[model samples]
Target: MQLLKDQERSQRAIKALIITPISLFIMISGFLLLKDNHFSQVATTLFAIVWGTVSVVSFFYSLNLIVQVFPLKYYNKIIPFVFVGPAILILGWYLFIPTLRSLYLSFLNRNSTAFVGLENYKYVFTDRTMLISFRNTILWLLFGTLFSVFFGLLAALLAERSSIEKIGKTFVFLPMAISMVGAGVIWKFMYAYKPAGANQTGLFNALMVAFGKDPQNWIGTAPMNNFFLIAIFVWLQTGFALVVLSAALKGVPNEIEEAARIDGASEFAVLMRIIIPSIAGSILTVATTILLAALKTFDIVFSMTNGLYGTEVLASQQYKQMFKFLNYGRGSAIAIIILLAVSPVIYYNLKEFNKREVF
Candidate 1:
């Protein structure tokens, strides 16, 4: 009986190996034929649906068949790989392939029809508008990340001690419920300006009018407008930092803080030296996350100022290059530069995540 079972498993494994490739080839050929217009539109759609369904079923069937053929001890060891392999492949196909293509396109000309080497990169670094965009991007990263994290830390600390903790946090986090574009629209109203003698529809302008001052075009001001734009992002991200850092703070042992207090440490010292140090990792994590968000901020700026009046950042500039100016090379180069700038932060963040998982 044992010899028969072994022979049957071996034969089944051989059959699976043979059938898997054949099914895959058939699936690919069917799709290719459909793409070649060998079928009507309705038929083509049906064929695609059938092909996808069969492909998934056949893949798992083959996987299970192979697993059955393996000895039980080896099967247990290899099962994790069988499930994880497909996801890894999908992730690579979606992520790494496009990144490589973008990098290749960055070295090409405007239409991506000819090689331009580093010309696009040089323009990104030296062009007047590009330089301003770079400066604005740095400003956004610094101010947006700094203020968001600061306010978040403050909110987390204050909320933890508040009688109405949930209600207070819910209100502070209310802005987060608005989409970035929606928040931009709401703030646009807040920052809206009318002539000094008009009805003063904007909230800020109305306040100024009530206080006997003129209405100002807040977003039309050049460098100051950039900071005004950064404020919108800070408002949006503060809640995210608050939530993450608050969770981290909760994880810190109360015994340490109480002991510090008993040793004659002031409240300021306890927070500065004890609580902050205990949750330093979480702080760095939240800061890096907000930094990345600031680096890639587009919708808020695009919706509000549309990169006008010297409020452009790298992402907005890239959008103008690719869509408005139709300059693929310069756009891709800017994108690559942005990617390179954020890659280190992303790497460090991931490493910290791994460390947290390990410990």
Candidate 2:
């Protein structure tokens, strides 16, 4: 009897092992069938059927494990997802299929017919507008992030001892809570300008007029308009910078500051030598986050200047190409180009943080 039971248990184990590997192999092979364009339709359908089978098999396998941990009473909860099976169907319809389609579309032509074979990618590198947008993207990565970090650091330093520090921080962080579209609209009003003669509603133009300078069409200007648009991003980002760096600043021990002070260091010298070094990791983290944000920024340039007048960044250019021109290949190329540019910086920053363990 014992030998018979042992053989049965071993058989069950082998069966589980066979099912798991076979299920996974089918799942993977379903996707590999897409190598030929001629097979794309069949391969796409195969993916859905094979993936669904894998999911059903894997779920039962995983369900037994989950049952051991979660109480039996909660088993009712799992039954609902089983009933509404279509939430998953909706995800494939809205998210997964569309994403796969876009990636596939990247290989096709401007009209999405007769494969262009990376001509769009070549334009991403060689076209004047795309190149200009790339340069502007770099400027945003550098100056936009730097300004946000600098101002946030300054605010954190200046507000550390204030009675109204909460108020000051709240004001600074208010922009962060606002949606990007809202911030863009707000900055539009701030940068609002009329022709030199009419009364200006724009805060910037009002200030210019206050200084007796004529209110110019700020958005219509060359290269400098890009800077003006970038400023809006910095303004919105600085508060977040301040909050994170301020927490980091507080971590710098008072003993170190006191020792620097006792050694006859000026306040600025103490901040430079003690505070700055103490918070360098946090500062780098904030700067990298800001760099990512600036790289991805679309609404500010879109709302303020619409990628016109050399204010184009990759994100805005991608939107204009995909949505406005309906050029899927060019749009996907722009996206891939921006991803290629920023991915390294982001990867490096992630590696540096892991090396430092700053978080």
lDDT of each: 0.91, 0.82
Worst 10 residues of 2 by lDDT: 62-71
Estimate, for each residue in 1-359, the C-alpha lDDT of model 1 and write its tens digit.
88998998899889988988977887788778877987888988898899888877787777877787888788898887887888899999998897898899999999999999999999999999999999999999999999999999999999999999999888888999999999999999999988778898899889998998888999999889988888999899999999998898899899999999999999999999989999999899899999999999998889999999998899999999999999999999999999999999999988998987953
Q: Tell me the alpha-carbon RMSD of every candidate.
A: 4.3, 10.3
- Residue 17's lDDT within candidate 2 is 64
Task: Provide the lDDT at 333 for model 2.
Answer: 79
Residues 1-359 of candidate 2 have per-residue lDDT tens digits of: 87775676566666666666766666566556544444567777776776777766775664343333333466577655654565788888986787667767778887887798878888888999988998899888889998999999999988897889999999999988887788888888887878887889999899899999988777788888888887888889999999999999889999989998998999999988889998888898898888889899998888777888899999999998999999989998787766666788789897997897766
Residue-pair clashes per candidate, as listed? 0, 0
- Candidate 1 has which clashing residue pairs, if any? none
The whole-model C-alpha lDDT of candidate 2 against the native structure comes to 0.82
State the displacement of the C-alpha of residue 89, model 2, in Å, after optimal TM-score superposition. 13
Best by TM-score: 1
